[model samples]
Target: MRFLIDFFPILLFVAAYKLQDIYTATAVLMAATVLQTGIIYGIDRKLQTMQKVTLVLVLVFGVLTLVLQDERFIKWKPTVLYASMGIVLGAALWGWKKNFLQILLGSQLTLPTAVWGRLTVIWVGYFLFMAAINGYVAAYYSTEDWVNFKLWGYIFPVVFIIGQGLYIARYIKDDSNGAEKS
Candidate 1:
């Protein structure tokens, strides 16, 4: 259920692209994202920072794409988003000596400080890698190819998330028996 909600917009965007064109797909994506955000807010009673940022970016870029009739705006949206996240995370970790990831998830996961730092670094690297790859594809590929890549490129995030979960699993303390699980 959560997975479906998270991917609702992207799935709709791909379907719309297949059925129509990039502009139509952009519009569909914008609407689907707005709906997705609303659904998330309804379920959680609030919106996360990332969710808000994603909604704003989708609407802004989608509008630009439609108004200008240029696919580049929509295509580059992911790059911009990924790059911004990477930069913010990296800066928060190194410059400010703060780990945003830990700040956000520390209440839920009781990992060591060192583990949190490492996780933040890993996230920063992942975000930068995604941004670079998306930028490359969006700049060098045709719109159709970019759309196809968008559909298939989901594998990256899936793999990253699985890997992250596995990495963090060892550090997650088990409270069932009041003993460390790992």
Candidate 2:
């Protein structure tokens, strides 16, 4: 399930941290991530380029965590992941294609291009904020704080996304109403 897919990494991160040996934990995390990716790909019968790229990045960073013996590399993983998704989503708004969020939900939802653009910008800004916050926390806070933030910091983006959806629902008419026409 999508819920599990998102939560699994965080759970692994906690496990890795608790295990206390960066190299061994990194290997375990990397293996788990690969398996996760493979399962998703098998179920879908095709791998999204983004998913493949993400797996690669995670592996690379996980290895870096072991090699460098500093948790900073792993700590910044979400920041890079979110920033990349945000940029890609924002760029998709420039063309006719809606980004990942829309692709997943658009069948059951409706919103105009302007609304989508606004949503994308909001996401982009949030990602930037997350990246900055992650850097600050990892640099200044203890490892425990960094881990807690990784789990709890998801709140900000979820709230922002819900707010965006509510705003779109208020302003944008349903798809059947032809409100999405540019």
Candidate 3:
């Protein structure tokens, strides 16, 4: 559903890369991301901030990759995106004295204020770690290696998200018992 839709562009990019070349894959990724955003907007009538940022970065970096005939542009995209998210989260938490992650998800997940703060810290660390890894792989590795990492690196986020779910499970209110439980 939403997960597939969000990943639609990356999936298409990978398939196109396998079928053709980097330029072709870049074009496909750009088009697919635009289409994905359009479909989301048509249904929701609004795009999340992160979605909009991703769309813009895909278009900008994708076009640069095509225009400059350099794969570096495309390869650097993930690092830029991850770094931006990390910066925003860290800034919100420290500079603004706010936890934007908690603010964003507070409506859906009810937790003690302390839990929310800790969750925000966890997300900030996760994002920073991802950013660092992306930067490292993009800089020190070959284009082929970076592309391979793009596919395999998804495992990190998946594992992190599952860990978050497990950590939050204990905090979620139980409807059956009408109380929180460990």
Q: In model 3, what are the clashing residue pairs, if there are any?
A: none
TM-score: which candidate is best? Answer: 1
1-182: candidate 1 lDDT, tens digit per residue: 98899887888899999999898999999999999999999999999889999999999999999999989999999999999999999999999998999898888899999999999999999999999999999999998899889989999999999999999999987688676554
lDDT for model 1 comes to: 0.92
Better by lDDT, candidate 3 or 2: 3
Give lDDT: candidate 3, residue 178.
52
In candidate 1, list every pair of residues with a backbone clash.
none
Candidates 2 and 3 compared by TM-score, better number: 3
Model 1 segments beyond 4 Å from truth?
Answer: 179-182
Backbone clash count, each prediction separately = 0, 0, 0
- The parts of candidate 2 lying over 4 Å away from their true place are 87-110, 170-182
**Cα error, candidate 3, residue 70 (Å):** 1.6
- lDDT of model number 2: 0.75
Residue 149 shift from truth in candidate 2, angstroms: 1.5
